[model samples]
Each structure stands twice: as C-alpha cells, then as structure tokens.
Target: MDFQFLGGASEIGSLGLVVRDQGRTLLFDYGMTPTDPPSYPQPAPPTIDVAVLSHAHLDHSGMTPILSRLPKARLVATPVTLAVANLLTRDALKIARLEGYLAPFTTNDISSYGSRATAVDRHGTFRHRGIEIEFTPAGHIPGASMTLYRGAKDILFTGDLQTIPTHLVGGAESVECDVLVMESTYAGKEHPDRKETERRFRDKVAETIARGGKVIVPAFAVGRAQEVLMALASSGFETYLDGMARAVNSIYLSAPEYLRDSKRFRHALDGVHVIEHPSERKKALREGEVIVTTGGMLDGGPVLYYVGELYRDANSSILLTGYQVDGSNGRQLLDEGTMTIDDTTIRPMCEIGKFDFSAHAGHSDLVRFAESTRAETVVLMHGDRRELLRDALSGFADVILPANGPSFTIE
Candidate 1:
C-alpha cells in the first residue's frame, strides 16, 4: 500500500492525501490554502475512486468542488457536514471569485458535489470495492468525523479533532486504527480548563462592562459561535449575537441531539438580540454592553464595525475566542496592536484579551490519542509550526510529517 501527501503535509491549509491499496485508491480532504490569493496546489492523478471528507472546515473540505470534476468520483461525509459544506461552497463561490470565475469550481461544482455525496454516522460504515471504512465522531464541529479505513492495512485519519466536551458536540470517539493520520492543530501547550476559561472570559467581560464600555467577542460562524453564546448567556450579562450567527443558529436548532446542551443553547439565546441589519449592528455597537459577532478573524463582519468604533476607546475590551490563522485581520490586530479599516489604522486603546478555550486538543491530548490508537504509521498535519506540533510528535518514531507532493509506502 502507498499514500501520497498531496497537500496539508507541512502547512495548515489545503490538506489532501491519497491512499492506495492495490487496484483501489481513496483521497482525503481537498482544500485550498486559506491565505490571501488562496493558494492552489498541483493537479491530482488520473483517477480516484472515492473522496472522503471528515468535516466542513475550508482547510479540510474546501477543495472538494475543485476535485470532484475528476470524472465519476463519489463524496463521503456526515449529513450535517454536507449541509454546512454546501452552504460554505456557495459562499466560497461568491467570495473567492477571480476574473469572473471561481478558479477551482463554480456553483455547478457545489451543486454536483451533493449529487455524488453519501452521508454516514458514527456507527455506520461503508465499503468501496474491497476497502472497508468506518465513520466516528471527531468532536470538532457539529458533523465533524474521524475515518477508519481497513484493507491490506488499517489507517485512521483524524481531520480536525477535539476530545473534550463542548456545548454542541460530544467528546471525540476513541475508534482504533493501525495507521493514525492525526491533526496537530494544538500541540506543545496545555489548555485552560473549559470551565476556567469561560470563567475568565466572563470576568474580563464584566470588567469591561463595569467600566462603561461595550465588550466585543469576534467568533467564527460555525462551532465557535455557539460556544460563545452559551458562555455569554451563563455569564449574567445581556449578550447580543449579530450577522451570520442568526441564520446558522437556526440550522443548529434543527439538529438538537448533536449538542451537549441544546436546552442551554436555546435558553441562553432567549431574549438575546440577533442582529442582521447594518443599522442594527451599528446601534448594537453603540448601545449594547456586551456583543458576540462572527467572522472570527475580523476580516469583514459586524465585529469590524464594533471594533472600528469601540477599539479606539480605552475603557472597552475585545475578546478573541478562537484560533486566528496567519494573515487574517485577527492576527494582524493581535500582532500589530492595531487594525486598519477603509485605509485607516486605528490604534486600539481597548484592552485585548485571549482565552485558550480551544476546541482542538493540545500536545498532551494528541500524544494520548496516538498512544491509544492502533494505527502503525501516524501522519501529523494541521496547525502552525509555532505551536510546535511537528516537533512534539518527534517522540513517536512511527510519525511522519509529509510535505506537499511527498509519497510514502504504507506497508
């Protein structure tokens, strides 16, 4: 058996890998680079029988529309991932346009991706030709999953995982495998207890509110938005959610079992203002004491309007609750101690705070996962090198960190 690391080998984005056993071949992910200009990798081989997606993150599943043009390829994913991915692809088509065309795939690709798609749950398994596969909960997003493939050899691919219990998803599944392909999004560091992190987050918000300044929490519209809402509602302050959170929350309410505290989400959301209009967003920024908005990286969202106004005020505070990828306006704000909007660089007089309420496991968690899994050849991907995920896996002699285009024999 042989595996090709097409992308996501030595980087945080565009993770694609192909697993071949005798006459059959299967690929994983198929994402584009998240940075500006949106890096596109080289083309794939002549054919692949199946394309397995573990989640709906742009990095792990973004390139599916691009790759599905390869003849009669089939897509395998969970039901919610398909729903979220369809929305994500449509949005990508709208946003990632170049010269009046989406470089990888068009709206036609998004629509066709659903045609070749099949959904599987935790206990369900599928067989393509001779290879057997299992879908296990990844404990990341609503429908994120871990896949186990067994043929001449056994392999486990963890797309992006979180073992700890969160508001929306269950804890990570401990499904065993012989070759563990895991993501190292958070490594070489310890995370604060979810309870403590939320506690600190509330205290920080309270402090900002006491000083008569509104609090801003910029979040991603996916899983992160739900968690932030739960934290704020339980924090004893009036919290308002704006923009994409309204529409996404409605979808999340459609599937209640996947959440640990569906009642809490609904209860916490009661009386919570859901802002979608621009004037309301500005009014919320001007009047609301505490606000949670999506577009986590602060690239462009209602949060920008809040930050552009509130950031220059020393009494205010901005709370970042998720991972900020490189080149994102979030990182630029965090690193530069200032951000530019409409060509104006505004120095933030507001206190900037961060909480490590990361959904992904840290270094110790990854090691524990590796030791428990039965996989023989472990592949590490995801995360920035500054997180030291690559170095942290050095202790595992079986671990391989593939660069783009590298191929290895899985024997």
Candidate 2:
C-alpha cells in the first residue's frame, strides 16, 4: 500500500491524503489551510476513483470543489455532511469575496460537487473499484466520521477525533486497523473536566445575568455553537442564538439522529431566541440575556457587533468558548486585552474569559486511542505539536511524521 501526505501533515489545516493499492487510487480529503489567503493542497492525482470526506469543517472539506474537475471522482460523505458542507462552502466564498481574496472554486463547482456526492451511513461498507471503504462516527461534529479503507492493507484515517462526548454528539467509535492515520490537534494539552467546565461556564453566565449584564459567547457555527446552546439551556439559562448560528441550528434539527439526544437538542433550540436581523440583534444586546453567536475565533460575524456594543459597557462580559488561533482577534483579546475592528483598537471595559470547550481529543485521549487501537504504525497530522504526539505514541507503535508531498509505502 502507498500512502501520500498531500497536506495537513505539518500544520493544523489543509488536510489531504492520497492512497493507492491494487491499481486503485482514493483521495481521503482535500481541504485548504485557513489563512488570510487560504492555501490548498497540491494538485490532486490525475485520476481519482473516490474522494471520501470526513466532515464538513472548512479545514477538512474546504477544497472539496476541486474534485469536480475529476470526471470519475465521486464524493462519499454522510447526508448531514453534504448538507452542512454546502452551507459552509457558500459562506467561505462570501468571506473570500468580501476580504478581496480570490476563491479557489466557484459556486458552479460546488453544484457539480453536490451532484456527484454519494451519501453513506455510518459503519456501512462500500466498494469502488478494488478498494473497500467504511465510515464510523468520529464524535467531532454532526457528520464527522473516522474513515477505514481496506485494500492492500487496512488503514484508518481519524478526522479530528474527540473521545469525550458533548451535548451535541457522542464520543468517537474505537476501531482496530493495521495502519492508523490520526489527528493531533490537542497533542500537548489536556482539556478541563467536562462536568467542571460546564459548571463554571454556567455559573459565569448566571452571575453575569444576575448582575444585570449580558453574557456573549463567541462560538463556531457548526459544532461549538450548538454545544454551548445546549449547555446554557440545560443549566437553566436563557440564551439568544445569533448570526449564522441560527441557520445552523435549524439545519441541526433536520438531522436528529446525528445528535446525542434529539429531543433534548430540539428543546434547547426551541428555548433560545433566534436573532434573524440586525435590528433583532441590536434589541437582544439591550437586554441582559445570554447570547451565543458565531465567529468562534472572534475574527468576524455578529459576535464582533456584539463586542462593539458591549465592550464599552463595564457590566457586560464576553466568554470565549473555543481554541483561539494565533494572531486571531480572540487571541489578541486574550493576550493583549484589546480587540481590533477596522482601523481602531478597543480596550473593552467588560470582562473577558476563555473556556476550553474544544471538540478535539486532548493529549491523554490521544494516548488512550493509540494504545487501544494497537496499530503497528501511526502517523500524526492536523497539529503543530508533532513532537509531543510522537513521544506519547512512541511506546505503542512506530510513529511516522511525514511532511506534505511524500509517499511512504507499507511493506
């Protein structure tokens, strides 16, 4: 079997890989690195039989439209993933146009991608040419999957795994394979206990509301936003869903089985007030309600508008609920005590707090997964801390850290 790391080998984004066995070629994922001007994977192989998508996150599915050019390339994903990917792709295009950056693909390409997509269920086995493929629940998001390929050799590709269950989805499905390709997003870090983190998050929201102050939670639209809303609702706090999160929340309701507790999730969605327009958002800010909005890293979106209004008010508070990438607005706020909006930098009087609501598995979880799988060879990707992950998995298997554009053959 020949395995090639196209992208997502040395960094946290642009995850892609190529596998060849028995004269058959399969592409795992073709995503783009999330930067000011996004970077895509090197050109795909001239011929691709199938392109398997693990999830709809931009970092994993951003460059999927590129597959449209391959006449024989058929996209394999879950129903929810295809639905969510379309929404996210359009959003990415809009952002690129607004920021004066050239988009990698056009809307027509996305349409072609959709027409060629083939939805598969979890654990269902399918064969294209000489390769057999199966997808299991990854527990990262609504339609995330851990892909398994059986060809010349058994290989497993874990796309952003999360061992710990969240309110939105259950934990990852543990599977055994000969060669394991895994993500190490939280290689060197340990997340706070889920129960304790939830308690603290709930308490902070309640306290801010009790003091007649609004609590703004900046979360990712897809997974983090839903999880935060569920947490807030379960804790007896009234939350207002704003920005693209409202649209995402509605989409979540369409696929009930993808969630942990469909009824509970729907209840939580019903409990929150959906802010549809700028006027409604402005009105929501005037009240002391807890608001959960998009732009998790606080780079843009309705969260910024909320920040602009509440930053000057000492009574309000902003709660960051995810990992803030370096040089992002969230990181700037956390590190330098200020947020830069167009041309001005604002030193907010309101309190700023960060909570580890990460969906990726932590260092301990990664170690446990590797030990349990017991693969002969393990390759780590989608993380900056490769050394930490290598050391942790050294005792379990032969750890291989391959860079982009290299093919390692298993003998």
Candidate 3:
C-alpha cells in the first residue's frame, strides 16, 4: 500500500491524504487550514474513486465539496458526520462571504457532494474499489471516526482522536493494524485530571455568579458548546445557550445515539435558556448568569458581542474552553492580555480563565493507545511534538514523522 500525505502532515490543520492500491485511489479528509484566509490542501487528483470524511470539523471536512466536481467521486462518512458536515460547510461559506473572501465551492457543490454521499455505520466494514474499509468511533466529536484500510498492508488513520470519554462522546475504541497513522495533537502534553478540571470549572463559574458577575464561556459550536452545557447543568447551574450552538443543540438532540447519555443531554437543554433573538441576548446580559456561546477560538460569532459587553466589567469572567490556535483572538487574549474584534482592540478588565475541555488524548492516553495497538510502525501527524511522541514510543514501535507531499510504502 502506498500512502501520500497531501496535507495535515506537520501542521495541526488542513488534513488530506491519498491512498493508492491495485490501480484505485482513495482520498481521506480534504480539509482547510483554520487561518484568516484559510488555505486548502493541494488539488485533489482528478479521478478519485472514493473520498472518506472522518468528521464534521471544518479542518477535516471543509474542502470535501471540491471532490464533488470530480465525476467519479463518491463521498463516505457516518450519517451524523455527513449531516454535521453539511451544516459546517454551509457556515464556512457564509463566513467566507462575510469576510470578503472567495469560497472554494458553491452551495450547489455541497449539495452535489451530499447527493453522492453514502452513510456508513461506525465499526461497519465495506468494500470499495476492491479495498476493504471500516470506520470506528474516534471520540473527538459526534460522528468523528478512525478509518481502517485493508489492502496489501492493513493501515489505520486516526483522525482527530480522543481516547478519554467526555459528557457528549465516549472514548475511542482500540483497534489493531500493521501501520498506524495517528494524530499527535497533545502527544507530549498532560491535561489536568478530568474530575479536578470539572470541579475547578464549576467552582469558577459559581464564584463569578456569587459575585453578581456573568460567566461567559466561549466554545466551539459543534461539540464543546454541548459539553459545556452538560457540564454546567450537571453542576446545578442554570445556563444560557446562544449563537450557532442552538442549531447544533437541535442537531444533537435529533441524533441521541451519538452521545454518551442522550437523556442527560436533553435534560441539560431543558434546564438552559436558549437565546433566540438579539433582544433576548441583551436581556440575558443584564443579569448575573452563565452563558455559553460559539466561536471557541474567539475568531467570530456571538462571543464577540458578549466580550464587548463584558470587557469593561471587572467582576465579569470569560472562560475559554478549548485549544486556541496560533493567531486566533483567543490566543491573543491569553498571551498578550488583549483581544481584537474587528477594528477595535480591548484589554478586558474581566477575569479570564482557560480550561482543558479538549476532546483529544493527552500524553499518557497517547502512550496507552500506542502500546495497546502494538503496531509495527507508528506515523505521527497533526502536531508539533513529533519528537516527544517518537521518544515515548521508541521502544514500542518504529516511529516515523512524515511531512506533506511524501509517499511512504508499508511493507
């Protein structure tokens, strides 16, 4: 089997890969970088037989519509993933237009991709172009998956995996393969213990509320927003849900089986106030409340509105609950003590806190996963600490750090 790393090789975003065997080519995850003017992967081969999407995140499925232009392309992903991808892709197009940038594809292209999509169940095996393919739950987000290809040599692609179970999704299932292509997002980093982290988060919110100050949690609309809602609800807090998260909440409710506890998730939604109008959002801001909004990295969304409103209040708190990529407003706030929203920059007087509510496996978890798989070779991607992971797994397997546009053959 010949594997080519088209993108997402040394960077944390814009993941794309191509696999060729027996005169058939399969593409895996054609995504875009999450930058101001979001760069994309190299042009996809003209005659891709199958394009498999691993999840709904823009960095993993953003460029999928490009494949729609190919006459023989057939898209494959889990049902929920495909649905969420549709939502995210449409949102990306809107963002592109709002930012005055040229979108890579049109709504019609997304529709065409949807028309060509085939939904597969998690852990189900299917044959395509004489190659055996299977998907296992990746535990990163709802419908995120790890793709397994069986040909001359068995290969596994870990697409943004998380082995630790969260309120929304269960832990990733372990699998064995000869060559393992895995994400190293937090390969050498250790997160705070889950229970401790949750306790600290709840305590902070409680303290803010007690002080007659509002607690604003900036989260990703898809997975992190729901997780924050569930966490707050479980901790006996009445929260407010706003922005694109409301739409995602509806989608999550529609697909109950994808979550860890559907009933609990529904209960969380029941306990929260959903902000449906601008007026309602303004009203919520007048009182001391816990509010969760979209745009986790603070790139844009209702978070900007909340930040602008709360920045001057020293008693108010803004909690960031995810990884802040470099150059994002979230990172700027954390590193430089200021946030830029549009043309205006503000140094908020509010208390700022960052929590590790990440959906990726940490150092110990990555080591456990690597040792469990017992693969002969482990290829690390999607992170900057490849050397750390290589050193950690040196005795367990042969480690290979690959760059973009290179082909590695598995023996």
lDDT of each: 0.78, 0.87, 0.88
**Alpha-carbon TM-score of each model against the true structure:** 0.93, 0.97, 0.97
Q: Write candidate 1's Cα lDDT for 1-411 as tens digits.
A: 788877887677888889888788898888776555677655667698888899887777778886567886778988878777777766666667632444678788888878889887755797767667898888987888898888787788899898888877877968777788888776667787888888888899999999888888888887888888887775677778886767767767877766777898888788587786776776686668888897788876678878877777889998898888777777877898877676777788899988776778777788787777855667777655523654655566377767678688867
Tell me the spans in candidate 3 whose CA falls farther than 4 Å from its real position.
Answer: none
How high a TM-score does candidate 3 get? 0.97
User: Candidate 2's residue-wise lDDT over 379-405, tens digit each?
Assistant: 888888888989988987999888899
Model 1 regions lying over 4 Å from their true place:
98-102, 384-397
Clashes of 3: 0
lDDT of 3 by residue, 232-309 (tens): 886666688888888877887888888889999998889888889877888778743888998898889888898888
* Candidate 1: residue pairs that collide: 177-374, 177-375, 178-375, 178-376, 179-375, 179-376
Per-model tally of clashing residue pairs = 6, 0, 0
Indicate which candidate wins on lDDT. Answer: 3
Q: Which residue pairs collide, candidate 2?
A: none
Better of 1 and 3 by lDDT: 3
Model 2 earns a TM-score of 0.97
Query: In candidate 1, how many Å is residue 58 off?
Result: 0.5
